[model samples]
Target: MYYSRKRLMDDLPEEVTAIWSCTNEKCNGWMRDNFVLSARPTCVQCNSFMEKGEKLLPVLENANHKQSK
Candidate 1:
């Protein structure tokens, strides 16, 4: 008999917030959320890897309010 751990649908982590575009003026590329077992995530756009999305700081904060100074 084989027992496979069942994951409850509701138990899954919340949806990841996607970082839209790059913050660097030289290359404002788009990015996607990445997940790793240990820690750290990489920007799909610029490949500017980070441990967590939050660590990116103002770079990832460039969501809708792009024009703001």
Candidate 2:
């Protein structure tokens, strides 16, 4: 018998979103803007400074992250 696995949900289309990219040339660390906890976030992988940038990513929401007033 042959079987095939299928995904439960359809793949979401990618969208351009704000992000923070690692300043370290050797590091490929990045984070979504809405997911950051600080005004200026650092790279979690290499602890390097991050700069503003944009990336094509699937739509995601951080329900647990509360925005500062």
Candidate 3:
């Protein structure tokens, strides 16, 4: 009887930056540069290996670490 609402989330700002993309064909996974682990970063979606790539994405940050300057 009613139409569905579009765009549920807020319009987050995005920019071009380096990221890791899932290598799996059936999976769509990606992580920000400042969010991946240095030792061995892996895709959390399908547990597959990720490759470095550049894409236009929203700026991401680690909420766990306190910003102390």
For lDDT, the strongest prediction is: 2
The true-structure Cα RMSD of candidate 1 reads: 12.9
Q: Write the per-residue lDDT of candidate 3 for residues 1-69, one digit (tens) a residue.
A: 664444423466778988888999999998876677664578898999889899987667678534331
Candidate 3 Cα outliers beyond 4 Å, as residue runs: 1-13, 60-69
Minimum summed lDDT over a 10-residue window in model 1 is located at 51-60
Runs in model 1 lying further than 4 Å from the true structure:
1-17, 34-69
How are the candidates ranked when ordered by TM-score, highest leading? 2, 3, 1
lDDT at 6 for candidate 1?
A: 62
Clashing residue pairs found in predicted model 1? none
lDDT of 1 by residue, 1-69 (tens): 674456444344554464444455666454343323223444555766443233232222325443322
RMSD of 3: 5.1
Instruction: Give per-residue CA lDDT, model 2, range 1-69, as digits (tens).
Output: 664443323456668999999999999999999889899898999999899999988788889678861
TM-score for predicted model 1 compared with the true structure:
0.23
lDDT of each: 0.42, 0.86, 0.75
Model 3: weakest 10-residue lDDT segment is 3-12
**Root-mean-square deviation of each candidate, in angstroms?**
12.9, 3.3, 5.1
